[model samples]
Target chain A: MFEGREPIYQQIAEAIRGEILSGALNEGDQVMSTTQYASTYRINPATAAKAFAALESEGILRKQRGMGTFVSDGAPEQLRSSRRQSFFAERVDPLLRDADVLGIGADDLARYLLTSASDASSATNTDQNNA
Target chain B: MKANGTATIQGYGVQISDLAVRYGSTTALEGVNLDLAPGRIHGLLGRNGTGKTTLLSVLASLRQPHTGSVLVEGQAPFEHEVLMENICLIRESGDVIGDVSAADALDFVEVARPSFDREYADRLAHSFGLDLSVKPAAMSRGQRSALGATIGLASRAELTMFDEVHLGMDAPTRQKFYDELIADFAEHPRTFIISSHLISEIEPLVETVTILKNGTLLLSEEADDLRRRGVTLTGPTALVDQAAAAQTVLGHTVVGSRDLGPTRQLTLYGDLDQRSLDEAERAGLQVGPVPLQDLFIHLTDA
Candidate 1:
């Protein structure tokens, strides 16, 4: 369940963040306790606790004093915003670099993005209509 | 039994200072000083003949250190009645009554170890598919290992050590054993020292890691810290060399580099700061983590 290359705690934190971003976990919903994470992932509880601590420090999760850890209020929005802040550097810059390496011009990339964006929106609309 | 009456018995911490042990004329361990914090799963790693078993034996009171003091939870474990009971060491050979039935072995441990839980042991045995009617001597090697694992888990000793006990079990059985260990540890928080050659298998389960090299302590660190300590860089040879110049390169040759051409990969053993990471990224050098298993091999290479 965990990759060996990076720290398990960091991976766990990223997983929870991904869950929040994907709407799998909602604000105010109680996340799995460290014990649950430990058993499910076959990892040490301390490692899970460390992940929770990192999330807590980032206000992505909050502990309710003996009850359990819950997704912080507006956690999804916070995560989305932070991800939005890094999107250009983490996503677009790499895309641009790859395009440059492929000898693709900026205009061509722009045209491709414009077409892809419309296609993605139309796909979303079709899914909404099906729902 | 007095300790068992308590709902929660915290695991014992260990303090070893200037410890040395000798077997006949050969010295097994020397100048060893280590402090293991309580209530964490620690991975003891080493190659063959590196005093891993010797250190565990000393901790379990099976053998006394010839030179220095060894303390468990504050008091010396050697010859101490209560401390000895709290410290259980399960070896790869499965330390149980071979002649007695598997059920009877549990009964024996229940009598000797105050913390032994019969109900839990029964449940574990069922999960491991260990037949209680069969004697350990009659069981296969894997079954014997399962029996040993059952005793170790059910013992619930404050400080439990498994000295390569999982080596006998096959892959799926080892997986089950690790899962059970994590689950049980969650319910009952205690110190665990697992010494095994399967570094990658146990990497996720250990909070702290201690590596021994030929009768001496090589490195003792938090598992997470150790993971971050070794970084790998792979890219253009000039870029990789430039990035590695500022860091502590682990070895002379690149780990997986072939042909010594335009691209090269180097393993470095040290913490890489954020600035250096950003620099490596800008330079088009791919920075990756070194697995604990690889790091162990590199550090313990003859």
Candidate 2:
């Protein structure tokens, strides 16, 4: 039973989300059919259908009537925008308060982030070249 | 603590305390304490002999708790008309009048429950292809179960508890039940506690889970939190074991040896980042996460 700690549909949504984030599932890519997901996950078809329906509502995926569900083009961009909107209020402000408590300034954090971003971009390029 | 009659209390949830029920020397429930909130779907799960039924019976006041008090909306439920009307507990075996037909049973429900929706009941009966004239004794087990389910849903009780009521149902019918349950909840929000052994099957319908193990409440965690708290790592036995030494092993299997098989599987109650994944892969390991059932079984068994 997939009855762990969390609503089951959220888990299904996150699984598809992970695929999308990792580029395994590209925008406009056909996702698993509802029946396919149900059988693969051993869940009721209705449950799997709910998850897909939720993604459709969020505009991450769209249904094609009898054709099946497809990931909406620019879904990754939409997801990123939505997450960033929440991140500043939910995470950055708290981090800033912690920084104030620890006597860390904005300049110090900015420098650190800049260095990290450069390193990450270079690492990604190296990985792509290797692949 | 005072025993009030059922009709006087409303909006409050069901409560049980120091509840102990014993059959001879065997204790079905031992000093258990639980408070079921209203309007949310709660999941009750435990092993076959671990007293899930006993607890529900006591909460519904169908059976008296030997040593403690049970309350529905702050009133005793046994023989209490108002509270009984607001509560429906569907046991594993359908609880219906054996001599009465399905239609008669629905009529009885209409008299008993103030919130009973006649149209909904009729629709459900028709959808299930249940004959209103057929007595409970004549119907198949699945049909009998459906009759009970239909009554439970259409009753519109403030608190509804289904204890594996769909066990006799076929896959398609069961799926229909699951969807209808949610659809009903959407139209009218109420407290629903569903107990079933098929965790993966009905996982989507549950909001929170109360896990029981060997008669003790093991954990009551939000489903999402549990999913985020664990992972599965498989690879070389030595490396996998070493990595998982500091964590809990929910389950494991011998997929293969050093070169060809999955040497070990580890479940950790925390997140593993890409770096951790890379480290594991470098050590010739495969990493994943445990599903809910695996997590439940592992946690309960321990």
Off by over 4 Å in 1: A4-6, A118-131, B1-7, B248-256, B259-261
Question: Cα deviation of B4 in candidate 2 (Å)?
Answer: 29
Question: Which ten residues in a row are the worst by lDDT in model 1 chain A?
Answer: A122-131
Give candidate 2's TM-score: 0.66
Cα lDDT tens digits for candidate 2, B1-302: 11254432223376778888888888888867787776667788887888898888877777888888888777899888777878899876568888978788888989988888999989987888888899977888888888888988998888898998987888877877777777676556678888999987666567667887666566676655665566666766688877665343433332222333746665566543445554565455556655667677767764
My TM-score estimates for the predictions, one after another, are: 0.92, 0.66
How would the docking of model 2 be graded? Answer: incorrect
Displacement of residue B25 (Cα, Å) in model 2 is 3.2
lDDT of 1 by residue, B1-302 (tens): 42454666669999999999999999999999999999999999999999999999999999999999899999999899989888999998677899989889898999999889999999999999999999999998889988999999999999999999986799999999999999989888899999999999998899999999989999999988887777778888888878777654433334444325788888777656646766786656778878899988888896
Reference-based lDDT, each prediction: 0.88, 0.74
lDDT for each residue of candidate 1 in A1-131, tens digit (9 for 90 to 100): 56544688999999999998877888899999999999888899888999999999999999999799999998987998899998987678877877898999999999999999999999867854763
Interface RMSD of 1: 2.2
